[model samples]
Target: MKRIVMKFGGSSLEDGDKILHVANIIESYFKSYSLIVVVSAMGKITDELLKASERAEKGDQDYIKSFTEYIKDRHIKALKASIKREEVQKETVKSVNELCDELYKALTGVALLKELTPRARDYILSFGERLSALIVGGALIDKGLRVKVLTGGEAGIVTDSNFGEANPLMEATFYQVKERLEKLLQDNIIPLITGFIAEDQYGRITTLGRGGSDFTATLLAASLKANEVWIWTDVDGLMTSDPKLVSNAKVIKSVSYEEAMEMVMFGAKAMHPRAIEPAMLYKIPIVIRNTFNLEAKGTLITDRVQVDKDRPIKMVALVKDVGMISLVGGSMVGARGTAALAFSTLAKQGINIMMISQSVSEADISIVIKREELSKAVNSLELNMLGKGVVREINYEDDVCVLAVVGAGIKYIPGIAARVLNILAKEKVNVFMISSGSSNSLSLVIKEKDSKIALQKVHDEFELDK
Candidate 1:
């Protein structure tokens, strides 16, 4: 039997009506393939829960109590509207209350300590999906569809113990998933798997970081070797640029895996970069479609797809609040150990260096970090390598943003860099740092506030017509 994995984001199942609409879409597709649905929390539930968690972390006990009840009430209300059976209603309500109690206990601990660790935060945030899966699965069963709800761990995903940024264990996970899913298909059941949260070898609950549900879906699709993976969200598909930023931004009909990965990494809102990895690994095509607009074909992402070369750049992406640090020293020039020491220093401080570029002689290395960690990173580097011949002057620029121009076709084309810099220079947008690889992708760090203007200037320079 042909198998397909479909993932629905929060907005796709925000309300009762939306969920019913999702159910209809699933029903329509289920006959053609053995369906596995991955669901995120409904609407802003995760955000609301985080706000409540923050209040708890602030020692607001009364607020915690009220917020707990508010969460419980909200889920109960949504369940009431969606599920018609009295028995299922009672069971769901009981399950919801139990989950709330668990959350309340966890929140109380966070309040007493006035600190929320990533592990605790992941545990708290996971409740939203837990609650969502139950509601969605129960509702589908009520609609006469055979369904089973499974947490990410129960659904056979085993990841590393990274707490918030778990990495999947491929072999073990794929085998487990294949066995479980094959059985489910044999029993004629639709498995509604909770996205984002998985377990490590020790059975510890861990999340796949933010925007992880999409990653979860693709991983499952690859593991099960599904015929296709559909990411159903609110938007039609991957647009040329953010629609709000560029009103004329048009939807990309088909995008190569390389293009999609680069776009998401540099801030395209289509899907997370991690979501595409598994699909790319197994050569499975991913369809990004709107759940609300079922008639639309959405964007298909495949490996090595040919794109028109008329446009110099395929897409412009901006990642804001970036800080760039330039490490320069004459002694660092043509030195072998100097580069390793600089990177080791940042690694020791646990600061993630997003983009990096080095000069020909290795005398200067530029690294980009998050603005929030600028002080710590700078201080650590200054203390460790400032006068040690490894680094001389450390220049920090906090108000910078990274714009990436990504496409495979750009590799075979010449003078692309000149065209990009010319456009930005013409717009008077100063480029702080420029880095390009032989892989045909180029990235430039610019003033954070100038990100949008730079993006527009470059987009027009390439004449990316809708």
Candidate 2:
């Protein structure tokens, strides 16, 4: 039998009706493939938990207790409404109660200390997904599908010790996932894995950051070498532009992995960039479908794809609150190791550079970084290469947003830049800095507040609405 992995986001499992909708989708695919369903916490549960954590951090023990009880009641109510079998329902209720107790204890500790480290936050926050997985797994079993619940770690996802933003260690993860899946398949059990949270080699709980559940599904699909991975979300699929902004933004039926990555990297909310990495490495294709509209044709991301030759730019995305820095130095121009040294300094400081441009003489280099990292980045560069004249002024600007116009067909098109600038001009938005890659991805930095307006203008210019 073919194997497939399906992941549902929090929005898809928000309430009793939503859970039933997901169950129907699962039932539709179960007979055709050995299914692994990964689910996120119910809608807004994680957010509520974060608020509870904040209350605890404020040293409000009474408020913390009340908040925790509210969360617990919500989950228990949802579970009761979703699951039908008496025994499974009883066990799930007990499990969730125990999990809530654990969370309460963690909140008490945080309240006493009034500090929430990333590690402790992850430990406390993981309960959301953990409880969801248990509830969903029990509901599925009650629906007559053989199901087993596994936490993210038990599903063979191993990450580094980074409490948040952990990356998977592939070799170990692949072997571990294979072994577990083999045993589960033999037992005729559908594995319902918790998404987002994993354990490091040292056994500390770590989260893969926001949208990490999508990353988990892609990783599992790649490791299992499955035919396809389906990411079921609230939206139908990737659209040409933000539908709210561009009223006519249409769903893209298919897009290349590169295009999808660029979109995600530049603030497209369809999927996380890390979600596509594992699938790309293993050459696994991914399908983005809407749980609400399963019959609709969604976007397919794969290694090989054909593009429309007539289109100059396929999509326009915006990343707000960007900072651009221009490093100018004549001595650095044509210098054997200047670029490497400058980059090394930033890397050591853990500063992320989003885009870069160099002059023909290499005398000046312009780079874009997130606004939040400007001070640290400027300090690092000044300390590393200031006195030697190898690096000159670090001009920083915080009021900027990067608008990326991306498409694989851009190489064959002319006047793409003219179109983008003219549109922004029409909208009366000033372009702060402009940079385009040799790979045909054009990016522009504009004032932060003008980001949405700029994106809409560019989308209008490209005729994306059609």
Cα-based TM-score, every candidate: 0.91, 0.88
Q: Which digits, one per residue and each the tens of the lDDT, describe model 2 over residues 289-379?
A: 9999867888989987555655667788777777888888778767878778878899998988888878889888878888889889988
Give candidates' CA RMSD values in order.
2.5, 3.2
The deviation in Å at residue 270 for candidate 1 is 2.5
TM-score of 1: 0.91
What's the number of clashes in each of the models? 0, 0
Q: What is the C-alpha lDDT of each candidate?
A: 0.85, 0.84
Can you write out model 1's per-residue Cα lDDT over 163-192, one digit (the tens) per residue?
879999999899888877778877879989
Which run of 10 residues does model 1 get worst, by summed lDDT? 304-313
lDDT, residue 151, model 2: 82
Which parts of model 2 are misplaced by more than 4 Å? 51-60, 112-117, 327-351, 372-396, 412-415, 418-430, 438-440, 448-454
Report the Cα lDDT for candidate 2: 0.84
RMSD of 2: 3.2
